[model samples]
Target: MVPVTTTQIHSRPSLTIIGGGPGGYEAAMVAAKLGAAVTIVESKGMGGSAVLTDVVPSKTLIATADSMRRASGASGLGVELGDEPARADMRVANRRLLALASEQSNDIRRGLERSGVRIVIGQGRLVGPTTVEAVTESGTEIIESENVLIATGASPRELPTAVPDGERIFNWTQVYSLTEVPEHMIVVGSGVTGAEFASAYNQLGAKVSLVSSRDRVLPGEDPDAAVVLEEAFVEDGVNLVSKTRAESVERTADGVRVQLTGGRILEGSHCLVAVGGIPNTAGLGLEEAGVKLKDSGHIAVDGVSRTSVPGVYAAGDCTGVFALASVAAMQGRVAVAHLLGDAVKPFQPHLVTSNIFTSPEIATVGVTEEQVASGKYQADILKLDLSTNPRAKMQNVTRGFVKIFARKGSGTVIGGVVVAPRASELIYSLALAVSQRLHVDDLANTYTVYPSISGSISEAARRLHVHL
Candidate 1:
């Protein structure tokens, strides 16, 4: 770890980063390694929403739900549980979930501290091109630096008609306070967040209704993957309210009442609003400091993460460049590399691998069928059902498929999608193949364990190669 001191501070370029999320902390570490004095201004915990509220907490809840789901199916694997059914304890699960989030937050803080990045617990605003005014618990402090990176991140957007009460009506962040499971849960907005919560709670012994304005759940995901998930949702007794918008929500004596666009009403013990998130770019003195922001209020950043101002940069959800923590970390690293005059590749959004953490996780990387269908890129496609895989039969898992895309003639692995349990782990090989420009033949020739779910990847590549 580097040591910080006043003598050495004058000898190196100084960097100040706002918001201690993955984007800010990661950049601080990188800049410190490059011999720059770095300081981080953060009002929240070190790991930001990814570790504290949104990513870690939600995934922990999902893990508990997944374990319960698997335990209930253990009888099929010859493990009988008599006649009584297993039940989930929401209080214990919530305690463990919050503990895990706090543990992760402390770990991140220690890592940044060990890397010699000065952390100021405060809200920071840009006062000049390289000057930051931080309002801390004690008092205001001014920081002068050669480079400034804004990674303030984002928060859940709320609607006026349907506000979260943190009880009957809740947002994604507020759901962690639930000590008792609801009798019936209503989830509005069938995007990734809504679908995940609906699936999780249904498996956790709650009647769930998923309301979607789109024609299908997960409208942005692979069409085939969405179909499989929708089927599983219905099978698990999750009521699917498709092609309807939630107009307003009001608390009843016992539960909540949600009014739909077409004058239909749905009642539930609780309602979770997962509409979307808004970037945390307001009141940062951005416009006054000459930092350009998009109409949506996200800081506009270039490929290297530079803002409109020469020395100012931005990353993470605030930049609206893929709202994933992995992408945020990469953008932060790129920003520091550019600041230190290192040879760096521009951040590529197309190469980012993302996953939706549902029962059958949906993982995707590179190009998509939509991109090829747009007539801009020529590509060949192949789809292989997991039902054909021996592992699927062994595990009684019959709800996923693998789809791959390649160049029309050359057959280079351009992009692919995986829908299965632990698909997040499986997509890495395909991501590496696409990023490295590996041919379909390369993947086909690679040795995969017999009777493994990953075999489907190699087999799909082989089929594509044969056709090519």
Candidate 2:
């Protein structure tokens, strides 16, 4: 297929988007395809935080860490390395990850340009509800448009007392700059971001301490899955500091000192603050343009990605939604479809597929175990341990499960969770089941390859077939 030329897209559409993140870039592509001239203003390079700093870089680094973990375990599978244990050079790993992030950002830019969307590099703000002003390195450009979208994304939430200095102290973004591994790493937060980093660094030969204000790590995730991860962390020698908060983190002469609640103190070679994120909604003229924002500063948007004001919309982490790239992309598409008189559906939270990048990933879709227990939805649930799977035994994998939730009588799949190696890949089948409203019997009757982790999904569905 021939690519659309930039000249062809230069009509008076003036569809201006602030931020070149997942939400903005995806919206630009869809709008351009619909024959609308689109302009995207990005302070950072293309692909935004999800690609340039957070997801892409972190996952690339974790890949190397995972390889090291597998190598160390090869002896258990009757394989042996040389006299020395396989070590990862942090300098090499960091360089590779940053390079990959740059390449990904460049790829996103190429895609947008190929789609005939104009790229404006600089800060963007709403001059009015229907107008956007971008301050680029060259000069300022005022865009008057009937459609405007705010997808400025977010930054890591920081505490006043514990700030990231990008040296001994770091946030999620700054950790990529490390040229050497630390002897000890202290992570503050037990949620998805915190737990993921802790798991990766631990696998990378660092003594990790995961400090949590909750009872256990991943307080927002599945309890059963959390138990499996906590057990794994224990076996991996990760220090779990639960039900406490970090009062302060100060850089020491050698490393850093963390003062926890109850007057407890801990020292580490490096500290990572992963409490959460704050949307980049400030200085965007949101309120002046009559755009309502929540107390957390996230732009308030409806199911269709519309803000309080008309002709304006918001998507992605800036909206404080699911914060997944796929969800953000879909929200962007929905926004465009609504504007262009195309068929569009509201946001369906249940159909959202979420994956956590850890040793054994935790992936879930549709209704959650917590939601079910709270009587939000009634269903028959079954969990099958991977330890009992033939393929899992062959891989020497013992830490995961495939769980299915189906409604009684009808036996239609409503929710599912997979806690296993590459659960992200395994959870797609369950995602299809829940989204298509497929019945447990249908899943059970489906053919699956023998001695595979995916077989566990079919086996679990077969067990749930009795509910029919």
Candidate 3:
């Protein structure tokens, strides 16, 4: 963060933020730094759903699962990993993830206090445009500020027939409570969250069956990238059920029974419903405060995080914007910056990068292949297979690729998709290229370590240079 001189106002601008997730706590820090007297109203300790339940915990579990995957695959690489499933301990992994979540929440709270932001623990809501009411178990407190930001995050949507019991039937958040890996895990929903857990648990020595309503997994992601990930999932022994929706999930005498479309039955030790997330917008008094909400119940906000009513703003999953934690943090920063009259940049969807945490991760940013194919934008695209890379051969990596899209005439990098191990890490250069509008030649000329998988990124760019 760049240091900026405090605003020379007679009285410091006062900002009150509701919720303490990345969108709320990060904004409080920024608002305080910008010379605003900041206060945060939170009910879920600190770090909101992202840290306490969703992103942090799930990623931690995936890390353990990844370690297990590497250890199990070592024998093929001439490294004998004796006694399979020794390190794949679910109880330990669950305990560690919960500890990490709690610690992260505390850290965020401490950081907010250190930044001179006041923390109010309660369920906060908008009473009027600039007035917030926080209700706690003991009492209620009303707060008034020049600017109010609603950053309450979201929660996993429960199926009408399959409510999570936090036992055999679990939601994404409830899975962190597992004492043992499921003997056979039936995951419903083939989106990022579903695919991630399915991959992670399967890596952790569980039989995973992924159910998708679409014809293939990751319906919203790039089709080519989805193909690669689906292939990897199948090779890893994941049972892929496509074009079928779960009619119901019921616990059986010994395990669980999932009734799919057309009367199909899947029996598994556990069931996970990763259907989707609904915004935590109800009961927030948004409508009474003249804030417009979308039909989907998400708070509607403009680019600068301004809601329907002036002096009221909303960010994060609540706003139904890009759902990544990074995007939420940026929205919060933008909200505070714009509110404090500081230099600000509106949210940029085109520059947003997202990754699916699968065995072979899929990361993408900027213009999509669909948009280009539909003549939404005239751009040249290039895809270089990771199998052709030197590092991939050395690592015995067989799948995934680096795909880049550039302007048709100038070869300026506009978009990209990467499917490989740690594709999230390999995608930053492409994101930077798109953000900075760097030409293909610029990326192609950049230095990449020899025998690196990331070389495919620059190689893809180099290939695209010829398209123009």
Candidate 4:
């Protein structure tokens, strides 16, 4: 492998990015391209959680599930069906996931190199506001830079009472390591991660029991979207336990047993914990560097991604903005632009779109009813169900809807939600509209193909006039 040469290194404003995930690596790329000598320190492989264990692998698995669902729907479209059910090979599917993750990681590393960024495989800690100490396999090296970016990302949140053993009980990051599929999988925490895995495993023929601490599957998502997923999970024979919290999990000889807060018990062949994540901020010298941390232990940053300390900034989940990869990348770019004296827009948390990778994925951008109810926004909401949509009926997808929230007087699209197949893709248009401060009139005026799922989106926008 060709190493970065000393001659190529410059004495200009130097940037050192710690963690080398989407945020770190992307910041390194931006800083390098902007004539800043950049160095990235990475403990794990490139692409971070988005590639190795979280986004890429989970989405790829969802893709396989999608294909299976489509094939099942083929019979409804008058296609022939076989008496035997289709089979999914977990080993083959996992092999493909790993291969894709590796390829993407390599591509990210190569891109950083081509952009004139130096990458060192090590765990980086902040020695000061502008100095990073990297512990590599060879030894430790302290690098001084003009600016530092922390993108250490996060790890799966585990409960002390019910920890993941990585065998019978697994965390979200460890679930992908499975070669053989479990016969019965109990998913604790019915949030985004839990819903996605439950949906995938249910589709893959696993007996799934989804445990939720809230009244619905996706408590934090759009209300209509949550309802749709709850119905879908029920139709697929997924046992939905609402308002139930797993107090503890223990590995049994035959499988696993989970004790609930209310003294209820759930037994399954395996348990996957998807409660949440904790930022990878410990022992990073953050406190010593004078960076302020939030109550939840996430680094506090301004709109420009700058921490309390000058010359030090943070992005991605470490900042706890939206916890979305897209938002993380944008924040990283925003940090670079601001530091490099380039024209930059302040990071807007409201405009970031996020998706939960369930069967009929749920994607939302901007505000929600809960936000409005809680006085976060006083916007009016318009909802359109997919049951009346031609494409949804044709596809045999009976559940899901499109909902949009806009300022009552201005009609500016403050927020929107989509809960249908490819909802992740559909939420982008709304994200753009919200980011650009577009109004309902713009969405209503836009043309959508007849008999398309997106037509419902337009209809939802059109209905906004009634409230106005």
Better of 3 and 4 by lDDT: 3
Q: Per-residue lDDT for 356-380 in model 4, tens only?
A: 8888888888887888999877888
Q: What is the TM-score of each candidate against the true structure?
A: 0.97, 0.97, 0.96, 0.95
**Per-residue lDDT tens digits of candidate 1, residues 1-468?**
322222114568889999999999899988988888999999988998888999999999999999988988898888988798988899999999999999999998998889888999988999888789888777778888889999999999898989999999999999988988889999999999999999899989999999999999999888888999999998889999999999998899999999999999999999999999999999999999999999999999999999999999999999998889999999999999998898889999889999998878899999988889898779989999999999988998979999999998899999999999999999999999999999999999999999899999999999998551
Candidate 3 residue runs with Cα over 4 Å from true position: 1-10, 83-87
Between 3 and 4, whose TM-score is larger? 3
lDDT of candidate 2 at residue 466, scale 0 to 100: 72
After superposition on all CA atoms, what RMSD does each candidate show versus the true structure?
3.1, 3.9, 4.7, 2.8
Query: Which segments of model 2 are wrong by more than 4 Å?
Result: 1-13
Instruction: Report, for all candidates in order, the number of backbone clashes.
Output: 0, 0, 0, 0
Question: Which pairs in model 4 have colliding backbones?
Answer: none
Q: What is the lDDT of candidate 2?
A: 0.91
Where's the lowest-lDDT run of ten residues in candidate 1? 1-10
- State in Å the error of residue 319, model 3: 0.8
* lDDT agreement with native, every candidate: 0.92, 0.91, 0.90, 0.87
